[model samples]
Target: LDIAFIVEGSDNVGEENFNIVKKFLERVITGMNVGQEDIHVTVMQYSETVTLEYSFREIQSKESIIEKVRSIPYQGGKATNTGNALNYISKHTFTLVNGGRQDVPHLVYMVSSSPSTDVITRPPRSINVIPIGITPNANIQELRRISQPNNPIILHSYSTLIEEAPELVLQSCCSRKLWTEIPELCNKPMDVMFLLDGSSNIGASEFEEMKNFVRAFIESAEISNTSIHVSVLQYARENNLEISWNVPQETEKLVEMVHSIQQREQGPTRLGRAIDFVVQNAMSESHGGRPSASKVAIVIVSGRSEDTVEAAALSARMNRVSLFPIGVGNRYDEEQLRTLTGPSAANRIMKLQNFEDLSTMITLNSEFIKKVCMDPVRECIDEDGNKKKPGDKWTLPDQCHTVTCFPGDYTVLESHQINCERMPKPVCHSNLPAVKIEETCGCRWMCPC
Candidate 1:
C-alpha cells in the first residue's frame, strides 16, 4: 500500500497545534507495518505553498518515517490551498518514479483545520482521499466533496488527533484490504432484499440519493441468477414491491429499474409492517428466493416507525434472514435500529448523519457482501431431533462427553476428555476416603463415608 499524509500548515494551524498533528502522524505510522516493499509512506505540507516533507522513495523504514514526520517544519502561510496539494500528490507523489506501485493501493490522508480557499475537484479513482477535518472552521461539505462515496473523519479539536490515531490506522488498512478482496468475496449465492423508506419525510431528492446508493451497491456485487438475486420494496403507509427477484434480469436492466423508481411520499413510516410484508412475499421461494441461498435484508429507514419492529425483526432472524438496518438522520430512533438486527447490532446497523451521507455508504458494499457470504447462518440438530444454533453447547445424559454446535454445515463437536485439574475436588463426609474414578482425559473423585 502507498499512503500519503497531506497536512495543512496554514497560519491558522498554530505551531503548538501543528506539533499535535505531527504527533498524530507519528502514532499512526507506528501502528502500520511500514517497509520499502510493504507500505510506502509520504508526507506533504500545504498552505499557499505545497512542500514535500518526504517522498515515498525517501522513507523505507517505519522508524525513519516517524522520525522524519516529527522533525519536518510546518510551512506556515495565509491561504489553505488543499486543492493544489491534492493535485500535486496525484501528479508527483504517487508516480512510479516516486515509489508508487501500480498494483498497490494509493491512499491520501488529508488533515486540515480549515476550509480550502481554492476550488477542489475529485481526485483520480486510483487514489482514495480520506479527509480529516479538525475544529469548527473545517468545512464538512468540502471534505465530503473531496472524499466522494467515502465518509470523511471529523475531529472537533486537534487535541484528539493523537487519541484517534489507532482507529485511523485501522480504517486505512481495512479500507485497502476490502477494496482488494471485494471481487472474490461477492461471488457467493445470496438473496438480497432492499427495503426502502418512501414516506413524506423523505423528499424526492433524498430518495434519489437512496436509489443511487442501491445502484452503486448492486453494481459492486456479482448479480446473476446463480450468484446474487435482488428484490426492491418501497414502504411508507403501504408497501410497494418495485422489483421482484423472480424476474431474471441483467445487471444493466436491474440498475435501470432502480433508477426509474419514483418516490411514494406518503405518511406514517410503517417499517415493521414492511419487514413482515417482505418476509412473506419478496423472500418466498416463489419469488426466486433460493432455499439454499443465504438471506439478507437491507433496510434504509429515513424516519422513526409508527409500529413496533421487534416482532417482525425477530421473525426475520428466526427464518434465517440477516437484517441490516441503515437509519438516516437524527430523527431515527436508535433503539429501534438496534432492535432490527438483534444483539449483533454493531456489525449490522448503520446510522448516517443525513440523507446526503447515504451515497457514502456505497463504499460498504464489500462489507455487506463479506457479512452475508463469509459469516452465514448455520444450525445443528441433535440425536433427540432438537434444533441448535451456532455457539451452543450441551452435555449428554451420561455426562461423559460434551457437544458443541459450531457454525458452517451443522458442525457438531463432541469431546470425551475432561480436565480434572481444573475441576473442584470432591468433599468426603465423616473423614472418609475419596475414590478416584478414571475417565478418558482425567479422573473424577467419588466420596465415601
Candidate 2:
C-alpha cells in the first residue's frame, strides 16, 4: 500500500502557489480516511533529473513528512524528462528483493503540465503509473498508457477545472483497496483460503489456467515477506484439498504443483461442498500454533458452482469468513460470487469473461491486494502518535499525529524544480508547541488556530 506522488512540470509553480499546494497536499494526505501507517508517501520532482524531494519510506512520521514536502521549492526547466524520471524511479525507488513476495501495490501519481520528452525506455511492471494531465499541454495518449483502466480523457485545465475533474484525481491516486467505497478500511495482512471449482463445468485445463493467472498476478508486486497463506480446496463432484495452509515454508511448492493438475470437465460444480470444507475445516482448525479462528478470507474461483450453493454459502457466512469470488470463463456465476463478496463489503467480487486472459484478471485483483493490504498485521501508531496499535481511533488535535500535528494548504502546480539550482538559504521556521485539545463532540468543531 505504498503510495508515491510525483509532481512533474517543465514550468514549476511559483513559490507562493507551490507553498500553498504543498500545504494543501499535506492536508489532503493527512486528512485522507486511510490509516496513516497504511499510507506511506514519497515526493519526487522531475525536471532535467528526477530529484527526490524526499526519499521513500522517510515519511513515516506524519509531521516530518509534511515538513520535508513544505521545504521543497518548485523549480521549472525548459525540458520535461518524464521518461527519465520514470527510469530513475525504477532504478532507485524500487528494486527486486528476494524475500519480498511481490504482493504490495506501488502507485505513482504524476502531475504533469506537459508531455514526456521524446526520450523513451522500458518501464517496470512493479509500478503502476498514473498521470494527472493538468492542462492542454498535457499529453493525452501517453497518460492513458501509464494509467490504469487504460483509456482516460485528460483534464486539460487543472487551474480552472479541478472541481469538475474530481474523478480524475481519484483514479490516479487510488492506492488502497476498498478505497472509494470503504475509505476507512486499512490495507492489512490476512490469512487467505482459496476454494476453486473442480466440476465438469471447469475442466483441468481451465483450472490450471486459473492457477497461472493467480500466480502471475501475485508475483508482480513490490512487497517482501508478505504474509499470504493459501489453502486451496478443489470441489467438483467431490471436495478435496489440493493444498494446505499450515505449511508456510512449502507454500510456493503447493502453488507450483497446481499447474501439474489435469483439467477435468467433471460432472458437477459442487461449489457448496468446497466452500463448506474450507471455511469449516481449514480455517477453523489450528495448524502450527496459528489459530484457525483468526481472520479468514475465502477466495473462490470458478465458472459456476452447484445449485445448492446458498446452503453452503450460508454456512460460510455464519462461520465469519470474508468471501471474495473471482469468476472465470464466460459462464460466470455472478449471483454466487456477488452474494459471497458481501452485500456491503467494498470491492466485493468481479468475474472474468475469459479464462485465457485470466492472468490479466488476477493482475487486476493483485492491485486490490496491494492497495488494501498494507497494514495486514494492523497495529500501528495512530495519527495522535500514540502507540495505540493499528485500527485505533485517534484523530486530530489529540497528540503529535500528522493529521493534527501538521495541517496546512496544498497546491498542484506545473513548475521547475526549486531545489535543482543554487538558491539562497531560506529562513527556518520554528515549530509551534502542541496545545492540549479535547475531542468534545467527536466531531470537528470550530476553534482558534
Q: Judging by TM-score against the true structure, name the best candidate.
A: 1
| 1-449 per-residue lDDT for model 2 (tens digits) | 56666776356444444454465456645644333445566778877777777665453556777778777878777778888887876676654431111356766666676778757564565576656566557765466555533223344354433343344434335533411222222233355555666676665546755665545433432211234455556667776666565554343455455555554555787676667767667665553214532345545465566555664554454444567676665665677775564344436565565564455333333455443344322223222224443223333332222221111111111222133123333333433333333353222222234
Top lDDT prediction, candidate number: 1
Which regions of candidate 1 are displaced past 4 Å? 11-16, 99-103, 113-116, 119-123, 134-151, 174-181, 188-191, 194-270, 280-295, 300-321, 325-368, 374-449
What overall lDDT goes with each candidate model?
0.77, 0.52
Taking every candidate in turn, the Cα RMSD to the unseen true structure, in Å, is 16.1, 27.3
Residue-level lDDT tens digits of model 1 in 1-449: 88888999999998999999998888888878788668888899999979888887785898888878879987799999888888888788888898778888888888998999987767887787778888679987678667754546767689878886446555645445633424656466788888888998888867877886777566656787667888899999999989988776576788779979999887889999999888877789888789978888889987789999976875576566788888888888888887787654447788788765565444533555566566544445443547877888877545655667767635444547667666776677757767778885567878875
